[model samples]
Target: MLLATINSSIVLISLPAIFRGIHLDPLEPGNVSYLLWMIMGFLVVSAVLVVLLGRLGDIYGRVRMYNLGFLVFALSSVLLSVDPFDQGAGAMWLIVLRVVQGVGGAMIFANSAAILTDAFPAHQRGMALGINNVAAVAGSFLGLVIGGLVAEWDWRAVFWISVPIAIAGTVWGYRSLHELGSRRTSSMDWWGNLTFAVGLTALLVAITYGIQPYGDHATGWTNPWVVAGLVGGIGLLIAFVLVEQRVEDPMFSMHLFAIRPFAAGNLASLLAATSRGGLQFMLIIWLQGIWLPLHGYDYESTPLWAGIYLLPLTVGFLVAGPVAGRLSDRYGARLFATVGLVLVAGTFIGFLLIPVDFDYWVFALLLLVNGLASGLFAAPNATMIMNSVPADQRGAASGMRGTFMNSGSALSIGLFFSLMVAGLASSLPGSLRSGLTAQGVPSDVAGQVADLPPVGSLFASFLGYNPIQTLLEPTGTLDSLSADHATTLTGKTFFPQLISGPFHDGLVVVFLAAAVMSLIAAAASALGGAKYVHQED
Candidate 1:
């Protein structure tokens, strides 16, 4: 689980290095889709396939499916590290392999919880799942730190690190683990699987492209294809629900949602996951794009430092998660889960209060609090949902839970980026034009640079690239400027200062929305009612 989840995010911090190694410029207007896919393809595939894969696990054996997943993961990691092409083709190779990797990841995600539930008694399941869940969630954050350290040595090393771990896991799981969970004798729901996969894929793909500029607009939301994807995706998903109702052996057990704890816990999980995912991106951009650079870190080094500095957040999770999980076992998950989300909501409001260039201690404190709150919520919520379902449906329930959380992470990239991009678009062009022209750039050159989509600039910053350098170099404007002007334009502080106001505008909306979501999650968590475990006689 750790290896799978770690690989999911290891690529994020190492992307600049990976792109450089592939000789692909991700910020180029024509190549932006490649960049988006690089980040999202694995997530989208995992989100779409987990339920189907989990259902497969139930039909077959979870250990069998899980063992197969580790083998797939091991092979895909090797393929990812050894790309035989460059430029767009190289990017395509990596993206395709990543989707394969997502398949392996989905398998692990779908069965890990059900396997644990089978292995542990009810009294001990909370602590066991809590520890496991922490590793699952914390691995994403740890990937940032690990990716930065490894990428500094070699870009391919990012994928290479996973090989031995996956191979070891495969062997160990095959030898040591056996199927303890209940299995159903049923055929596959081909229609349910097809509709769900296509529908979800279309929706996520549309969301991925929605942040890019389209036909003079700041975003692709109005694009014909994107519109078609949205409409079609939603239509098919509705069909999926209908089909599930009729199918004797449905891929998704819609009836499981009739259980209050399962339904409400999933709702809270989805909202919390979305907010958590958004927070990760926002913090990375905050550090890599603005805070770290303004504080004198170089663009190329921001990814590493950003990861290191966020250790407090990881620590908070490590400390609180198991404790919360253990306590929830004795008491009820309802109180802990609800209180945790309320705290999570408070922390988001705390973030809104901080300045763009915030004091380190203040930022770290808030991050720590946020992490603690998240840890407090995650295990109990997961335990509550998993426990509420019948033993026979545990695999599907785990998959459904995984689907919501994974899908929420996928959706957050689009939702938050769109909100942030919209905020940047409103005033960024004027700021860029004026800032550049004042620094001795020609008016036409400055206008052209400013007129470029704000998404490019945002991505540049997010990827730890010098935004001014990237924008001005293409126009050959920096060569024309005096050394002083060039130096000021490319220096750490200039772009961060220029963009901070607009960035703050976006931050306000993003963080406020996150806080609201957390509150609603808390409400949902409360609605989950008292702790009640389902027992099948």
Candidate 2:
């Protein structure tokens, strides 16, 4: 699980180097599709497959499927490290391979919790799952530093590092882990599975693209294709629900929703995961794009240093996760999970109050609070979810829980990104135009530059490129300008200083939305009722 999550996050931190290695400019309008695919493909595939895969684990041996996952993950890591093309083809190769890797990830994620639940008693599930949850949250944080350090040398190393871990885990699992869970022999619900997979995939893929610019519009939410996808996907999902009801052996046991703890816990899980994903992306952009540069970190070093500085967050999670999990075991999950989410909501409010170029200590303090709160919520919430289901349904329930969480993360990249982009759009153009003009850029060139989508600037900053350089180099504006003016325009401080206000405005919008989601998650957690052990059938 640690390896799976670490691999996911490594890709996030190593993206700039990865894109460069593949000879793709992520900021290029035409290439944004590639960028979005690179990020979304793995997530979309995992979200779509985990529920089905979990059912497979229940039908077959959980350990068998898990072993296959390890082997597949190792092979995919090898292929990713040895990507053999450049430019668009290279991007496509990585994307396709990542989807395959996500297949492996789904297998592991879908079954791991169920296996653990089967092996441990109900009273101890929270502690065990809490430790597991720590692997997830902490691994994501650790991957940032690992990817940053290795990507500083070679981007391929990021993928390479996963190989040994996959191999070791595969061997160990095969050697030590056994299938302790009850296996259900049932016919496949091919129709239910197909509709669920295809419908969810279409819905998520549409969400990924809906945030991109469409013609003259700020977002593609109104694009005819997007609208079609939305309606079609929702229609298909409705059909899937209907199909599940009549099936002899439904892949997704919709009856699980009747369990108040299971249903409300999933609702809380989804919203909390969405907030968590959005916070990670938003903070990365804030640090890599603006804050780190302002603090005198070089563009080339920001990715690594951004990860390093965020360690306090990991520290808080590490300190809080296991202890909270153990505490939840004795005290029951409801109070802990609800209070944890409340704390997380309060921290998001803290984010809204902070400045874009915030002091390091203040920023670190906010992150620590967020991390502690999240850790408190994750394990206990996950335990409640896995414990609420019958023994026979545990695998499916774990998969369902994972689906909600992973899907939420996938949706966050789109939903929060759109909110942040829309917020920036209201003020970024004017800021860009005036800032460039003030720096001795030709007004015509400045206007033209400002006219381009703000995503480019946002991405340029994320990739640790000077936004002025990225925007002007293709236009010959840099060549036409005076040396002093060009130097001033391309300096790190210039772009960070210019974008700070607009970025802050965007942060306000994003964090407030996250806070609202967190609060709602708290309400959902509260509705999950007092803890009670599921009686195994």
Candidate 3:
């Protein structure tokens, strides 16, 4: 779980380095697809396959499957580090390998909880799962720090770090981890798995691409392919529901939803995961693009510092998660989960009210509070989810929960990103154009740069690179300008100051949306009633 979560997060902070290593400019209009694929493919694949893999673990043996996951994850990590191609091929190699790694990630995510539940008695499950959950969630934050620090030296080191961890885990798991969980006799639900995978993939891919510019529009929401993907994906999902209802052996037990705690826990998990995912994205961009640069960090160095600055979030999660779970076990999951999400929502509001270039202490405090809230919510909610389902169905329940959470996280990239992009589009063009012209860029050149979608510019900053110099390079205006003007134009603070207002506008939209999501999650969390542990049938 630590390895999976770490790998999942490290890539994010290391993305700019990875792109550079591959000789690919992810900010290029033509290469945005690679950027999206690099980030989204792992998440999408994991979301799509976890349920099926969990069912497989139930039918076969979880330990066997988990061991295989370690093997696969390790092998893929090695491949990821060894890409020989450059440019498009290099990016494709990494993206494809990430999908394979996601396969391994799905296996680990689907079965890890169920295995722990089987190993621990009901009385101890919450504490045990709490520790496990902290490792999973905390690793995400830690990975950012690790990625930033390591990628400063070698981008391949980001992937390489996973190799030794995977090897150790594979050997340890195969040797010591027994199938403490039940191995059932159900046959594979091939049809159900197929439809669900294909359908969900199409829907998410559509959402992913829908944020990109197309047809001279700020977003591709109206593109024909996206439209077909959305519609077709929905139709297939409907078919999947019908098929699951009819199938004697199903990939996911929809009947789990009849259990109020299970249903509510999952709904809350999805909402919270979406908000949490968006929070991570927005925070990184906020720190790298605006805060760090404003504070005198170089564009090329912001990624590392952004991660370092966010350590308070990880520290808060570590401090609160297990303690909350232990308390929840004594009290009830509902109270902790509900209160935690409300805290999260409150923190989001706090973020919304802050200025673009706020004080570090204020930002750090909010991040810590949000992290604590997430910690408080995560363990209790997860415990409730596991405790609500029957023993025989725990694997599927875990898988279903994993699917919901992972899918929500995946979808967040599209949802919040589109919202942010929309917010930026409203004012960024003029802001960018006028800002550039004032800096001695020709009007035509400035206009051309401004017309490009803000997503690329935003990503360039988020990735710790300045697009101002790159954008002007195409205009051939750098040579025409005096050295003083060129230096001033491409200086570290120039782009950050130029885009601060527009970025803040987008941040308000994104952060507010995240707060609403947390509120909804809180409401759903409240619906789970009190703590009631399930007994094996």
Candidate 4:
């Protein structure tokens, strides 16, 4: 679980280095798809496949699928490290292999919880799953720190470092683990799988493209292809639900929704995961794009420092997760999970109160509380959801849980980015044009730069590049300016200061939305009822 999540996020912090290593410019017009794919492909594949893979685990053996996952992950990591191509092909190689790695990730995600449930008694499941959930959630943050340190030394090392751990895990898992869960022999739901995959893929792919600029629009939401994808994807998913009802063996057991704990828990899980994922992206941009640079850190070093600074968030999770899980075991998940989400919402409101260039201690304190709130919610939520299902269906339940979480993360990219871009669209161009023209840039050049889609500037900042330099260099605008003007145009303070106001405008929308979602999740958690475990018939 740790390896799967760590691998998922490590690539995010390491992207600038990885693209540089592959001789690709991520901010280029033609190369943006490559950048988006490098980030989204794994997530989409994992989200699409977890349910099917988990069902396979139930049919075959959880340990077998899990061991296989480790092996596949290890091999893909090796392939990723030894890229023999450059430019598009190199990016393609990584993307394709990363998809393969996502398969492994899906396998692990689907079965890890089932395996633990089988190993532990019901009374102990919360504490055991709590520790597991902590590793699962906290590992994403840990990967940031690890990726920053390793990618600075060598981009290839980012993938290479996972090899040894995966290999050791594979061997140990194969030798030491055995199937303890009841196996259900069943036919594969080919039609159900097909619809689910194709439908979910279309929806997620649409989301991937929806954040890009479309003609005169700030985002691709108006693009014909994106619109078709959305409509088509939703249509297919509706068909999938219908098909699952008629199928002899469904990949997703829709009947499980009849269980209150399972249904409400999943609803809460989806919303919470979406909000959490949005928070992660927003924080990275907040730190890397604005706060760090404003505080005198170079763009090149922001990734590392951003991760290091987020340690307080990770610490809060570590401190709260296991304890929450154990307490939930005794007192039931309802109180803990509801209170935690309420705290999460409060923290989001707290974030809305701070300035972009916030005091470090204040920001860190918010991050810590958010982390603690999340940890308090996660294990108990997972325990509640998993415990609600019959023993024979644990694998499918685990997969269903994972699907909501992974899909939420995938959706966050589109949802939050669209919101941010819209906010930027309203203010960024005017700011850019005025900021540039005042610094001696030609009016035409300044206008052209400002006219470019705000997404490019956002991506540049996200990738830890100087947004001003990226925008001005190709236009030859800087070369025509006075030395001081040129220096100020590309300097750290100028762009950060210019964008902060618009960025804050966007953050207000994003964080408020997240807070509302958290409150809704709390309500859903409350509806999950008292700690009642499913009794086998």
What does candidate 2's lDDT look like per residue over 50-94, in tens digits? 899899999997888888999999999999999999999999999
lDDT tens per residue, model 4, 83-108: 99999999999999999999999999
Query: Which segments of model 1 are wrong by more than 4 Å?
Result: none
Q: Please count the clashing residue pairs in each candidate, in the order shown.
A: 0, 0, 0, 0
The C-alpha local distance difference test score for the whole of candidate 3 amounts to 0.88
Give the TM-score of each candidate: 0.99, 0.98, 0.98, 0.99
Find the 10 residues in a row with the least total lDDT in model 1.
1-10
Estimate the lDDT of model 2: 0.89
Model 2 CA lDDT for position 315 = 88
For model 3, the stretches where C-alpha displacement exceeds 4 angstroms are: none
Ranking by lDDT: 4, 1, 2, 3
Cα distance off (Å), candidate 2, residue 285: 0.8
Best by lDDT: 4
Q: What is the lDDT, from 0 to 100, of the residue 60 in candidate 2?
A: 92
lDDT of each: 0.92, 0.89, 0.88, 0.93
The global Cα lDDT (0 to 1) of model 4 is 0.93
